[model samples]
Target: MAHSHDSTALDLPLPARRHQTLALVLVRRLAGHGLHDARATMLALDAGGTEFRRLLVLARALVVDLARTSRRRILLAPCCAAGMTRDEGLLMAMIGGGGLDVHGVLTDDAGCAIAMTTAHALGDELERLATRNDWRR
Candidate 1:
């Protein structure tokens, strides 16, 4: 959705509404972590040239949430999380939504560790799919 400088909330397109909601979720979470500049961040994000551009900005901003070491809450960065691919982010959201604890992994040992989504049916499905996919690069 393209927002004109004069457009009001009621005039926003459907896709823009979704983008705004996702961005707000991240900004609100950031505020809880004592970020006073969240409103400013939101405004800047809204100024992005395109919808995908805005999403990318929001995703990168939420990466800060992923960096925080917390055991009480799970934070997601849309289609982009630190060291995570789009598929990984979607998988994490699916599994994480199942009332399970999830977190981003920062390990120097594996050299492959990234986000940690809970293991369940979704995880099993992902595993099966990955096994059949031999073109990993």
Candidate 2:
């Protein structure tokens, strides 16, 4: 008997491959923003379906914000895909529960270099994902 499985991204189905591509593109987008280990990040993402779509939308927004702002770094908390809702207050709730007094930061930057580079590098797929109204699909 021999084990059979998709050995490469190319071996996966079309949707799966698209997910992988999106994940890779996102990882690249984050690379300039102090994110490390592109390969590991891509693998850990395991992107697909609605949650994956949500992640893409959140990540693209975060990346865009990072690019535009002068924030030195972003603090990304670890959470499951199910927690990746569009609710902006979730992070604040998490912090409250943890007894942490954290608040948002504002920066002044006339021109953003990262926005010029990485945000634009993400291309139109991110915009498409962001604009998509049907997450169930």
Return the top candidate by TM-score: 2
Tens-digit per-residue lDDT, 1-137, candidate 2: 21132121232122223432344345444544344445434533554334454455544554556545644433332231212211112222221221112212211232444432333333334434434533223
lDDT of each candidate versus the true structure:
0.34, 0.36
Q: Which ten residues in a row have the lowest lDDT in candidate 2?
A: 98-107
What's the C-alpha lDDT at position 123 in model 1?
Answer: 37
Q: Give the TM-score (vs. native) of candidate 2.
A: 0.28
Q: Put down candidate 1 lDDT per residue, 2-64, tens digits, no spaces.
A: 212222222222222332334434433453443435543454454442333433343444444
Residue 80, candidate 2: Cα error in Å is: 3.3
Q: C-alpha displacement of 126 in model 1, angstroms?
A: 18
lDDT of candidate 2 at residue 3, scale 0 to 100: 18
